[model samples]
Every structure is written in C-alpha cells, then in structure tokens.
Target: MNTAPPHQQAALLRRYQHRIHRVPRNLVVQPTGFCNLDCTYCYLPDRDDKTPMPTAVAEAVARSASELVGGHHRKPLGLIWHAGEPLALGRRRFTELLQPFEELRRKGLLEHAVQTNATLIDDEWCDLLTEYGFRVGVSIDGPKDLTLRRTDRRGRPAFDRIMRGVERLQHRGVPFSLIAVVSRENITHPDRLLDFLAALRPVSIGLNIEESEGVNTERHPPTREQAIEFWLKVLAWSRRQPGGTAPVRELERLGRYLRMSRTQRADRAHLSRVDPLPTIARNGDVFLLSPELAGITAPTYNDFRAGNVLEQPISAILREAHRLSYVGEFLTGLEECESTCEFFDYCRGSQAGNRYFEHQTFAVAETDYCRVTEQAPVLALADTVRKERTT
Candidate 1:
C-alpha cells in the first residue's frame, strides 16, 4: 500500500481527477456469438448464433486501427476476442480470422487476447493460440459441485470438459488467467472457491459477482452487506496465501491504485469524451462502453449502436459517438459520479451496462452492481491496509 502522508495523498487524488483521455484502449471482438455451455447467468443475448465475422469485416476493423487508437504514439490497443466462446469457432476458422490483424500486430499497434469457457481446448487449438501469441482467460466458476450453473444445452455438467481443457493447457505449458462468476450459491463460500482456484496455479483470478443484467432477471443472494462480507473474506483469504497465489483480481486492482506513485496516478485516465472500451459485433456493429450491450437492443437508444465498422471507419464512429443519446447519457453519468462519488477515481462510473440493465437508463448513479464490485472491494482492501499499519 502507498505510505504517502494523508494530506499529500488527498492532494494527488484531486489532481488525478483531470487525467482523462478519449483514446480507445480496448477493442472487444466477437468472432462468433456461439457458446458451448449455457451458463445460467450469462448476459449475452445472441449466444446461439454461430455466424462468424466475415473476413472483410475484420479487414475493415484492422484498417481503422491506427486512426482509432491515435496511431503509434499511444500504446497498442488491446484486441480482445470475447462476448462469446471465441475458441468455439475451431482452429482453422479462428486462424483465418486472425490473419487480418497480423500487420497491426507486427506494427505493435495491437495486442491479441481471448476469453473462453475452455470446454473445447485441444492440442491444435493450443498450437494456434501459442503461434499467435494470444493471452488466454478461462471462465470456470469453481469445483464440480459449485459449477452446477455451467452446463451444456442438454443440461449436462460441463466441469469435466472444462477441466480437460484446462489440463491440456497445463500440459502444453500455456499460461492462463481464471475468471469465475460468483453466483448466490458460491458467493458465501469464498474459502472453497479460492482454495480450488489456487490449486490450478493460474496467473491471476477474476471474480464477477452474479448480476441482474440482460435477460437474466432472477437476482439471488441479493444484499449489500452479504456482498461486502464476501469481498472482505476474499481479501483476507488472498492475504493468507503464500506469495498471494492467484491473487484476487479486484483486490489486485485496488492494490495497484493504492501503490501507484503520484506520477503514475496522474498518468491514469478515465471520464473521457468517448468510452475507452468498444465492442465490435460479428457483423461489424460497434457498441461503446459495455461489451454486454453488444447483442442487446432497445428501441429508445437506436439499438445501442454507435456505428457499424462495415459502413464507416471506427474512428468516425467514435468521433461522433457523443451524439448518440445513450453515449451522451453515459458521459453524464460519469460526470455525476466524478462530482459525487468518492470511489469515482477507482471505477470511473462503474459500468454503463449495469446502469441501463438495472435502471433502464445510463444517466443514473449508485447501482447495486457498483456497490458490490467497486465500493466493497475498495473498503475491504483499505481496512486491511489500515489494520496492518496499526499492527
């Protein structure tokens, strides 16, 4: 934790408020909307669609990369294959899909990554992923008993297939990060979850608290206090590990924020004119702010599309994104959080998708999602650091 004096830290945080940028940092690409397993809490609306992105669409997106991220002066934009199981497209098609980004990768303007359920990993897939130098993130809830929510379309448990894939990756010497969703059944059992995750020896662990987003409306284990307690337990459990095995993702972010130097904090940016993260659908439509809004549609918000990369360049779409009502409302929400919320510096405005899904509007502040994901973790980590100092 940062040991700077209290007054100095407060002064630095106030200055950090102005460090906002409009540059696109992450481009989430959906190779296909097909997923092998029907996870119960999944927010995706088009997970059944097997239509892969046309090669032309990929070329178009690649062509606009330099302009979208402000050219080579800025760091490489993170090109993440997500929104569905990217690996489900199979090795041959996935390889062909990657061809368009080769020049961008060579130019150091793009970094490739994939987030998958890991139920289809094989030696061929591993070879392709390793050849392309793609960072992998596997989605697994926990042990077999806890992962009852992750099942196939026919209601068969997917734990065995998922582990088979994970073991194959381990055998291939491929490093991966684990992403788990903590639903009502597993939120109260952090110890078991952490222990199981640590045994996998992943590079890191990310936990997404079960949310009432998209079509999944049945909220479970709903309580602010329970969520906070769960996070505090997670922080305590992570600290007890030797060398912090598979460090909890939320706490790691908090630690980074707390330990950043004055200069580093000042260099960080948010509350920008445009959403820094953009998700490109299989057909080339672009959705700003939230990847969860890719397949979702609402008549009031022009279906939540900024523009289609197939019709215009990504730079043009982003340049005029503010004109979109939802985008403008999201910006307003950011301003409200910046002026009102103490945790604004941490989560920026908590996620625009959550605001819309929970309240049907993007111009709102203080949703249950932010309280659990942003506020609780910060409070838990701060309390831990304070206790350590006194000891």
Candidate 2:
C-alpha cells in the first residue's frame, strides 16, 4: 500500500468512474531491455536486462491493435518501437517482431515508427523501414564532446557511431527525425546543436529536456530565463528554413496553440487530447500513458501494469484499468491542472510519470517539465504573435 495519508487515498478515489478513457493514441512496444550504449542519464531501469519480448506478446498486441485501429479510424492509434535500443533487435529478428505492426500498416489501420539510437541501422534496416513507410526517429545529442554521457560499454564515445548511422540514413535518403535529449550540457549552446542538426537536414527535430525520472533523479533543470531563451533562439533559427533548416517539432506544436480555433481549443473532452499512450513491456506487461512509466514500482501503485496481452485484449484491460485507484490519482492531477494551471488547456496536466517522480503525487500541477516544455515555448511564441499584432 502507498501508506500515504488516508485522506490522500480518499482524495484520489473520488468519482473515479468518470475518467475512463478510450483506446490510447500511441502504443509503445518495449521488445527488449538490452541497450548497447550507456547513457549516464538514462531513466530506463531495465537497460542492463537482456530479456527480449516474447513473440507471443507482440502477436497479441498486434491482434488487439489491429482490431482497435480498424474499428475506430480516428483514434490516432499508432505503434512505437522503443523503450530501449530498438535497432539492437537486429534486422531479421526485428522484422519478425514487426510482422503484426506491418500488417496493421498494410491494411491502413495503423501507423508505425521506430525510435532508435540509430547505431545499428544497416542498409537492410533502412530498406525495411522505408518500405513500411516508418517515420524513424534517431536519438542524438549533437556534437561528440557534448554527448559524453551517451557512450558505449567500453566507455567509447557514441557520437561517431551515431553520426555514422545518421550519415547512413542520409546516404540512403531515408526520412527521419532527430530526438535530442536537452540537458545542462547541450542547453548552453543551442546554436551549435542547431547547426550540427541542420547539416544533417533531418525531416524534423524533437527536443526533450532531461527529466527527473527512474535513475535520472538528480535533475539540473534549466532556469526559466534559460529555457525561454533557448526555445526562442531555436524557434528563430528554425524560421530561417526557407534558406535551410530542419523544423523543430516542439516549436511547431507551440506555434499551433497561437492559431488554435475556438472549437479546437474548447474541445477539452478528449483531454490530454489523447487517451493515455499504452506501453507494452517485453514481458507483455501493459502500462498506459507514458512508456517511461514502465519498470518502476512504488507503494500501492504496482507497475501500473493493467494486464498482460497474452491473457486478454489491451482495450478490455485498459477499459478496466481506467477504474483503478492509481488512474484516479492521475486524473485528480489532471483536475488540479484544470483548476489551477494557466497552461492546463495546452498541456492537459503533463505526463503522469513526471508528476509522481517530481511531486511524489500524480495529482499535482506544474513542474520544471511543464515550465520548460509547455509554458516556456507557448509563452515565447504567443508573446511573439502578440507583438506582431501590435506592430
């Protein structure tokens, strides 16, 4: 049990039935716990475990996902092959794992993508990805020196190998996005990072600040001023795209808020704008909302594993899991954001895992995460739009 105050537990359970959501928008399949690199800040607790997901789990999830996406065309249900070094699965084995997902894609029922460190992307891997129309995402942190923490087991720098992988993708003309984890080191020089990425000419960029999760607990979150400046500068650099630059997805999303229609803004019923993203761990343990939420256990919460796909369908499990006490804790946090946060309409309370890690409760609002990711960019862009209107 959580052993928190009884009042706290009671608060979380109030009218919990009202919060049951539909099938998730994204389904993340964590096929293995093995990763070749040793990023010092990695939050995944299972990086050392080499257990690969059983083929049965993937089959079950694929079958369930096929049905969900097939029936509800507008749920935005998709699959993400992530949670560890996805490419490490190797081409042949990965293809088998991707069998169900490819079927979903072929039938036009779902979209699929792989978030890889891009270390093991051979020509064969690229061919498979491109053939299936997978929008691949490469994890990199710009220059070699800046990525000292993301090294291999032999303590070698990962920059060269990752860049080689990046180069391979470019050479093959494979469309991909760069997913960069912004930390204290890279946040200082957004320009150098931007320049390096622009040279590669990625399809897009995703910036994720170092979060206080799992073992990455000791976070050195950037200051409000620093975050504001970095995002704005990055946004400005991205504006030079007509000349040449990859679009930053974070800035693009923030920019969308500036131009949202009343209908778009007011449709708060689908809050978070999507149901919890589901993460099926290697062992068929299902977790919803955040893939990062997998492999962690605290008092009373359990793994938040709704059910195993081998035994039951995901939709059925999630529908029932929605009524669990832990879900109520998170939904209360959502209510907190709605009642208190200025950015509640924009962020829908941020990630549940982030809240529990930072605030020790899932029902709180506004962390350094919300400040840097949701508030800063929107404020920066919204301020710019306001200034343009005045001028």
Candidate 1 lowest-lDDT run of ten:
12-21
TM-score of 2: 0.90
Candidate 2 wrong stretches, greater than 4 Å: 1-21, 262-272, 382-391
In candidate 2, the residue pairs with backbone N, CA or C atoms under 3 Å apart (3 or more residues apart, or in different chains) clash, namely 333-363
Q: Candidate 2, after superposition: displacement of residue 317 in Å? A: 1.0
Clashing pairs in 1: none
Taking the tens digit of each residue's C-alpha lDDT, what string does model 1 give over 1-391?
A: 1235678555433432233235677889998998888988877888899999888888888877766655348778889999778888888788888898898788777889999888999998899888888889999999999999999999899999999999999999999999998877898899999899889989999998888888787756346777888888998887688974777778888877766634465546542333447788999999888888887879888788888888998877765555567765676677788899999877767788999999999888889899888898888777777889999
Q: Model 2 over residues 1-391: C-alpha lDDT tens digits?
A: 2344767655543434344356567788898878999888888888988788877888999888976776574734678889879778777778888886776777677777888888888788888888877879999988887778888988888888888888889999998999888888889888888788777889888888778887787757677777888887787677765754678888777656555744476645444454667789999988876777789876567767777898889878765664555676788787787899888777767787888778777777778788988888877777667877999
lDDT of 1 at 89: 83
Full-model lDDT for every candidate: 0.81, 0.78
Error of 1 at 10 (Å): 32
Quality of model 1 by C-alpha lDDT = 0.81
